[model samples]
Target chain A: MTAETQVREPLTLKRVGRFVADNPLIPLVVLLLLLVGVLEFMRPGIVNERWIGNTIKFAIPLAMLAACQTMTMLTGGIDLSAAVAATISAFVMATQVPIVGVPLAICIGLLPAILMGLVNGFGVAVCRVHPLIMTLGTGLIATGCLQVYQRFVIASGSVVPDGLAWLGTGRTWGLPNSLLLFVPMAVLIIWAQRRTGFGRLLYALGSNETASRISGVRPWQVFLALYALSGLIAGVTGLLYVGLIKAPSLSLVNPLLLPSVAAAVIGGTSIFGGRGGYGGTILGALILTVLGTLLTLLQMPEGARRILFGLIILTVTTIYIRLTEQSR
Target chain B: MSRLITKHGWTAGLLSILVLLFILTRMIQPEFGASGLDSLSRATLPFAFATAAMAVVVIAGGIDLSVASMMAVAGVTAAVLMDGAGDGMTVVAVIVVLLIGLAMGAINGALIVLTRVPDIVVTLAMLYVWEGVALLILNAPGGAATPWLRQLIVGPFLVPWLPKSFVFLVVCVALIWVPLKRSKLGLSIYAIGSDELAAYRSGVAVGRTRIAAYAVCGLFAALGGLTLTLSTGNGEPIPGPYLMASVSAVVLGGVVLGGGKGAILGPIIAVIILRLVRMDLTLMSVDPNVTTIVEGTIMVVVVMFGGVIAYRGRQK
Candidate 1:
């Protein structure tokens, strides 16, 4: 009986591997290419240098945020608080920018985001609280702090120094600075996930936390470090969000939470944890950006747009899970 | 006392806040003395019922974030069916509303079991879908909540002074709370959440138990929604979305996430305490947003602190 089972397992694995190899990124990449083709074809002048630059530019942060979120999720847990954490840090940093100087403010601004991430990590890793509840708890607290900050301090007519906002809005060779920063970060993350001990440990932990522990990996430390990375990435995104939008609105952070998860999941990262790459997340982000752009161009109502958004997320995720399952 | 505190965290916390709110209101508002308590009792009845419904699922270890949406859908369904059918059809409407809630629960449970999607994701997705479907039905709120609809929930019972909704809430607790604790279904729910495979190996029907839990969550959420429509006499898309926090309230009442240890009474007291806290803040001249901050912070601190306390107790 055991020999028969063993004989069948490899054959199943080979078929799964062949299926993935043939179809990976085909649907997502095809859709993205098709959108680009249609837009460029229909409005060659409008999809010109400036438009192309901006499209890629906005795609940068969306991609980076998705990538950062994917790293944490790779460990069989999610950081729902990422968007809010970014917002709080951004508001804090932006508020302090004029008073303390942009450089100093950036360092200080990064603190709150990192600290909250650590608290989140401690609750989940050390205390054994479920990640969803732990993060959800802190997410609300951070969001409340952002509200208080907005109402009392930031809304007290504080202005982020003109030069600082320029980092978000300014162009380097007609490309956004935020987008420029997103590039190196993405490359570094991809390398780390593929090669580094810490990176591999995250996947191992996510794949099976108990087995990883038994293999002598420190699960808590991995969780803490991963959360810190999540915090750092969110801090960067927060700064960029403020720079692009000019004013700090609570809604800016509120909506990003689900999309980031969707981006991660759609990018082929398993919501069940482990076995995914950031390449897929970049495509997912691009898909979302294109969808948003299309909806706006199409003049869809808010309700219809929301319905489409929810449906697409649900559909794509279900398909991804099914495909991955069959491959296994 | 420690045993009492642990078992009744929501209750003890709630009563203490109510007492504090009472004293403060008397010292300042003065007119808010006895009448204030009566107003509060009636005003908080629906939320208590909603929270009780929320607890049923929390005990079983799943989330029904779509409950508020389901409630809105069911309320609109009830109102539209009985609209101008008048006072005579109130009993029938109530029964139909309940049946609709049960049906919504059943569908949600079946989908979760079949798809194997995470409950949070499935329910979160359904939140929008159901609300969208509800909007498609009415697209506006115009129906009167009918006098009979109001009386069924709001009218006096044995005490003559007590709200019928409060009585209904208590009756639900009595019917569900004790038997659930003793039943095979309830115990198996805890087992499933604690560890799915072990429960299955132990001969518990994990899938059915979990599906039932989700179904029950949907039903409770529907009840809460219907009660809300009766209380307010309106059904708007806006209220349904904001009610997601009701689930959060249940968690604050000592229902651990990832499920297994909680009581209906815990959530019952939690909703009441939370309402009292908001009311107390209004008296104190704090902005209403302060309530959101306080509630959010309390949920985090209490749950975290609860873990620490439970850990300490185990060590002892």
Candidate 2:
């Protein structure tokens, strides 16, 4: 009976390992649940319906922004200018709402993001500049342009549109209103990733650019479209974030840039490209949001918080890589 | 002579550009007096060192995003140690700071090696870690340098135009960089950067070379920190605008982004050119914000031109 029990234990362990290898999301979901349990344990009844709603509300904009990173990183590139684009959209839309009303102001605000996207695309596709440097340059230029624009619009005064405010902060049946927007967006992104030709092309290019080019893929067009789409996503996120905060500043969404990249990376998206999905990124964003809550509850100093954040990211990524590598 | 010109064409082009920019600045502000030169040297010193530090790592085929943070850590630490200390103590403090920098860099290299993660990921994590350490050490902007130490580092050596900072830079380049360039380790660095597998197969100590490269980078970053301390007579925990500027300088100097090709002098000259351009814009009374736009535009244009050149070469 003891020998039989020992054999069954090893078999069960092996089966569990195989299950984890096949489903990467299982571990992340487990981690997320564990974090929630920890939070509940710490504060005793802190993890209620309202807490869940609030967490989702905050995680929505971050997930949207990380969507940009997930897509770009799929093609072995990144949009360093995403935060700048988001900030510009939010700042411009807020200021313009008082002058031209909501619809026109929103359209105008999105224009700059698309413009930056095209410029990034042109640099990467046409000029063949490295994506990192290209995005960095454009981000800087956008920030500078925003500052210059601020000098002119300082007198206009900014206002948050009421509709956006409702969408950003309102709740229904214990669920975040932002879900109305994010759910459709997330579904479309996930669907397009698996079922669309462009999505396949992104993976193909990333896995082997030369091979794809030789096989008749137009590298330039894919880059241009991908970056433009990333820009549009960033713009939308900016608008939502402005609504969430109900305030607009020159640096309004800038702080999210690194965190968005971290989210994409933690979601199992490879920085080297061609091995991740928006689904993982969504989970990553939620995990980060919960982690942030935990940190705030701990009431640690800013320095300690930052160090712990970095350390956790490093540890989690190492473990994730090890697990995924074993599957391969 | 022709071969020399062909081999060092980029260097010549960079130098000529530097000269032209200098002449243009001189034309704008005709006074361009000895004090003006002294100020230019002082302003360029920290960035020049920072750029050199970056160039070393880039040439070795790695990027250290935490370099600015390292400068911050070293700068603040030195400030805390050397504040109101005697000359002898101040000197000892400087050495200690440099050693700390080296140790920090070695740790970075080891982390990357041990984790088996990409350099960018490890360095990115380290960037946050080191920045947090800097914040912990000095939450606010306040640390002093003794007047005597400041003079020895930043004051004019013998002439008004040739500040001790410039002399110190030259001495560092001569004593440190030149030796490294001619040494076997230098060859190994170039080899590893160009092709790591090949280098390893050929008996180069790839891991050790990478660690040494990072260590050297750390030392230079520390030197940059010390320069900042001396120039301001106070250490600010903030790394300020040097991070992107140093990277731009490295690229503008002609180092390939993927690594394995470039000269340190080119980046030094590029740093000077960048500073000159800023001075020129200020002299022209352009909105200070416009400088950021111009800097970004310049980076794109220069890289585009390099791309065209490389494409042409490839075709040939």
Candidate 3:
């Protein structure tokens, strides 16, 4: 890794610069502020309480998906299989609800995601496979199996079952029901990292797997748990999306994968692993969602939208990397 | 020499896998013997080229998610440019697409080095950029590659029985792979991939070698695109299944994803194995999805098997 050098600056100036750079989420907050302010300016009253609520509603699934990315990245790996897992989970939930009922169907749907995550973990940890190919293969497997499932079992329809709508799109006291889910999940994730031994173990595993292995850390077990959590979170996101869209498709969550990774990275989590938190990812998710709305409001085409997203991810991640990387 | 051969445990393993797949293919599809082999090779050509393209970047300790997009850009660019060109424009069109690929790869490499960003971050962005660019250049994919250009990939110059796909692989191994592997720069590439700090300390031109690797990868990607265009006689924007497919094949071939290990022959053979697997699946009247499932399983298994190998290798 290269540590960029800059010319000397006065004491206070340097301190502020360093502070802004050190916190990955700080820049994101600035960006989020600027975006909301602009949106309000462009369309009067667009940035009201309702707007915030809607933004959060739109943001819930992305935040949940990004949370999965953060967990995987914390271990110095990634789960490219995330979107596929979420899609499969959603597909299952959609197809099974008629036969098994909503509750049982949801449980059954999440099982495949767990299995996929377990395979990814095994491949990365025990098989010593690189995470990129390992997760990608698992993703391919998930997609393939889903297609077969669709063909042989039941054809999934566009409409999400009525029973599934409440958790995804239900409102409570002017707040989205998904917000209820997001808050606890976010709190639990943050608590797990800050309070639990497993969280520390995850960071340690990413910090130096060989050292961790020698130190009796059982890297594989950690990987297994971390990845399983990733899958579970992805499953939750899939279910939420089905409720939000009212229609479940294999690609329902595909677009979310990149943004989720971007959101986590924008929040300051290192792709190399173990040095960031959920706070940054949450902000990152909000920024991405707001940016997305901004783009749609501007009527940018799909090509341009992708270009902007790509650029934002590149620029933000690099700045975060360069800034914090130098100090660490 | 024997020690050297043994050192490439992964490559030897891949070769055996290839042989096993070949025998199975021969046994299962006896009609696919001499006569049917040409079409099989033809169908596998684009992916085979793509796997090789991706292997180069993976070996350099970087990843390029934009492989298929680059191919798409190359294909569509060629078709769009040569659609109704005047005399001798075909050669110009080929060169242009190839250069476009090199430029795209260079951007990926440059961003990675200059920004000090992780390769995945940079390349991930580039994937979108290239795909977006492909969309911009040819929004709906409605162009035809030049007639002679399509023939060139198959090489009317070669023996009638031999597909241009196999011929291209042979040419690359002989011309590019063999020489590059033994060159001083190759050692530098391996060194940089294994440990950048150590490689830099050892006086390797890490940045340049990394850039060169992407350039060659870009070249191969362009070749892949041209091959696709030639095979289909038309261009398509969404040509990324090959990128994922290549990643799967690379893992199957046992090429260490972060570079510094594995032989060129590995992915080349692994591509064949995957195509054979797909062939077998199709012949059995299995849904196309099953092929993807089996490919994914094979990749998972190979990756898992690799973990054991690495563990035992570490102990030794």
Q: Each prediction's Cα RMSD?
A: 4.9, 2.4, 3.3
**Colliding pairs, model 2:** none
CAPRI tier for the interface of model 1: acceptable
Candidate No. with top TM-score: 2
- Please write out the lDDT profile of model 3 over residues A1-328, one tens digit for every residue: 1232334344445565578766656777888899899888888888877778889998989888998888888888888889888998888988887777777888999999998888887777777777877888889888988988887555544346675588777787878888878899999999999889988888888888888889999887888888888988898889888888887776889988877887888888888996788888999899989988887888766677767768877997887676665543
Score residue B256 of candidate 2 by CA lDDT: 85
TM-score of chain A of each: 0.87, 0.95, 0.92
TM-score of the A chain in model 2: 0.95
Please identify which of the two predictions, 1 or 3, would achieve the higher TM-score against the true structure: 3
lDDT of each: 0.72, 0.88, 0.81
Q: Which ten residues in a row have the lowest lDDT in candidate 3 chain B?
A: B149-158
DockQ for the candidates, in order? 0.39, 0.70, 0.69
| Model 3 misplacement above 4 A | A1-13, A155-159, A326-328, B4-9, B154-158, B172-174
Model 2 Cα shift for residue A95 (angstroms): 1.4
